[model samples]
Target: MATNFKIERRSAGGVRVLALDGYLDAHTAPLFESAIQEEAQAGNRRIAVDCTKLSYISSAGLGVFMSFIEELREAGGDIKLASIAPKVYQVFDVLGFPALFDMLETVEEAVAKFAEGPREG
Candidate 1:
């Protein structure tokens, strides 16, 4: 069995912060999908995925976001990523994901950029 991951959500300065721990690969991506779906269903749209402890991510995990980005955006909400590991960042960079999403280097930075907050340079 794959290792279980942890998903923690809390309201941070008006945005929903989702902190993820462990790997986000084929078997574990569904757990993440369900979490995001549940949150969306509840009308909690402003999402931030804090991946400080996420060690790995497969293509299927990437697809979860690719498939939901539009839905989230249409609802006047957005997804932000923070604390990406270098390995994970390489995967995203190789796939041109830096152009596809708002990625931050730290959790503090993510909290500062709430949905309606000022853009960071």
Candidate 2:
């Protein structure tokens, strides 16, 4: 069967949030990448990517995150992830993403982290 993916963008407590649902594979990774790019281009630097409904993710999906993180951080903002299901987290874990990025339990937590100030690199 063909996979499905969607991205919904919103702002919560002054931070931009991208909510993802469905499979995130090569076929659908561009959608996710575009969402992030638009947010950054608009200078909405602080972002929270909510993965609560994401059912699957391929390396291509993961690659999009890697592509934008530095650009966001350089702008004094960052992309934080939250509400990821176990399977997705495992994929991230195996790729050591948690070390290169921040992962929290909720979009609220991720947004709150941004308020705490830019992470000390």
Candidate 3:
């Protein structure tokens, strides 16, 4: 089946949150990328993607994150992942992106992290 996905962005406690729901595969990866770009364009530096509702994701989806990481970081912002499903976490772990993206267990935690300041790298 074709991957059906939708992205929603919101701001809470000075953090931008992207609620991603549905499969994130080759077909839907571009949508996710676009959402990230839109958020960045809006001056949303700190970003968290809520993946609790995300069902599936592929390498292409992961690539979108990779593509945006540098830009976000350069903007004094970062991208974080929260509420990720186990399967998706496994994928991130395998690719070592979980560490790179600051994967968190909850949206609240992500928000707090964002408030803590950017990663010191």
Model 3: CA > 4 A from native: 1-3
The digit string of per-residue lDDT tens for model 2 on 6-93 reads 8888999999999999999999998899899889989899989999999999899999999999999999999899999998999999
Q: For all candidates, what are the clash counts?
A: 0, 0, 0
**Model 3 clash pairs?**
none
- Write down the TM-score of every candidate: 0.89, 0.95, 0.93
Question: Which structure is stronger by TM-score: 1 or 2?
Answer: 2
- Could you give me the TM-score of model 2 versus the true structure? 0.95
Q: Against the unseen true structure, what C-alpha lDDT does each candidate score? A: 0.84, 0.92, 0.88
Q: 48, model 2: CA deviation in Å?
A: 0.2
Candidate 1: residue 79 lDDT (0-100): 80
Model 2 global lDDT (CA atoms, 0 to 1): 0.92
* Order of candidate numbers by lDDT, starting with the best: 2, 3, 1
| Candidate 3, poorest ten consecutive residues by summed lDDT | 1-10
> What RMSD value applies to candidate 2?
1.6
| Top candidate, metric lDDT | 2
lDDT of 3 by residue, 51-85 (tens): 99999989999999999999999989999889998
